[model samples]
Target: MASMDVSLKEMMAIDGAVGAVVVDYNSGMALGSLGGSKDLDLQIAAAGNTEVVKAKLRTMESLGLKDTIEDILITLNTQYHIIRPLTGRSGKGLFLYLALDRARGNLALARHNMRIIEEKLEV
Candidate 1:
């Protein structure tokens, strides 16, 4: 298991990582962040993604789906944005957001690594 800082640092080690953050879905704020270029403002991305999380949760509720979101993926022309909600009881309402360069990232490996990171993250 890893603490927030450790987890964030580890996430940054992923191949093609452009940025990563732990965000509060309810408040749309970043609890921690790392590796953002000038063009990628992680805080703003976190806030915008808060809506995406909320919308999906709302939709799931409306549809009466018992399933929860494992993760959310947004594929852009040049980037891959991944949103993974924290699952621990203490981690409710928080998520991990990662941005990667599609050409340089291995989507499968990144997703698998993110899952491990999420499991080990200490809220």
Candidate 2:
């Protein structure tokens, strides 16, 4: 199993990856991060994304959907943002955020790899 540091590093290696962070959804704080440029404040992004996760959870509860969220994809004009909540026992309350250049990213492959990383991540 990979440690959190290793997982974040591996995420940064993905094609078109611009930023990556492991965040606490409950607190909206990044536990770890890498690859964000000055233009991208990953800390702020992490906090904002926490709200997104919370909103989805509230929606799911209201809908009576017992299923867990796999991931949330937000496609912007030039970028693709992926928010994946960690499901492992030790990873509860945490999530991973990945930003990719839309033109260069392979969304399917990225999602697949993120799942793998999440599975192996050692909280």
Candidate 3:
């Protein structure tokens, strides 16, 4: 099993990745963060993304969906924001947030890498 530190470091290796954070969306708090830009504070980003996660959860509940969220993606002009929820027991109630430059990111690969990271992460 990979420790949380190792998993996060692996996340930073993804091409175009600028920052990554493990967050508790339920609490709007970051468990850890790496490589954030001065223009974007990781703390503020984590807090705001909590609303996105909550809204989707509310919608899913209303729809009576039984499945869990694997990940969520938000595309912007210059960046792609990926939020991946951990399915492993050790990572319960937590998610990984990754920021990648759109020009350099391979979305499919990034998603696959995130799945791998989530699988190995020990929380």
Please give the CA lDDT of all the candidate structures: 0.94, 0.95, 0.90
* Off by more than 4 A, model 1: none
Q: Considering lDDT, which of the candidate structures 2 and 3 is the better prediction for this target?
A: 2
Q: How many steric clashes between backbone atoms does each model show?
A: 0, 0, 0
Pairs with backbone N, CA or C atoms under 3 Å apart (clashes), candidate 3? none
TM for candidate 2 is 0.98
Which of the two, 1 or 3, has more lDDT? 1
- Which candidate number would show the highest lDDT if scored against the true structure? 2
TM-score order, best first, reads: 1, 2, 3
**What tens-digit string does per-residue lDDT give for candidate 1 at 13-119?**
98989999999999999999999988999999999999999999999999999998999999999999999999998899999999999999998899999999999
Q: Tens digits of per-residue lDDT for model 2 on 1-123?
A: 999999999999999999999999999999999988887899999999999999999999999999999999999998999999999999999999999988888999999999999999989
Candidate scoring better on lDDT of 1 and 2: 2
List model 3 lDDT by residue over 1-123, tens digit each.
Answer: 888788889999999898899999889999998888887688988988889988999999999999899899999999999999888887888899999989998989999999999988887
Provide the global lDDT of candidate 1 against the true structure: 0.94
TM-score of each: 0.98, 0.98, 0.96
Candidate 1 matches the true fold with a TM-score of 0.98
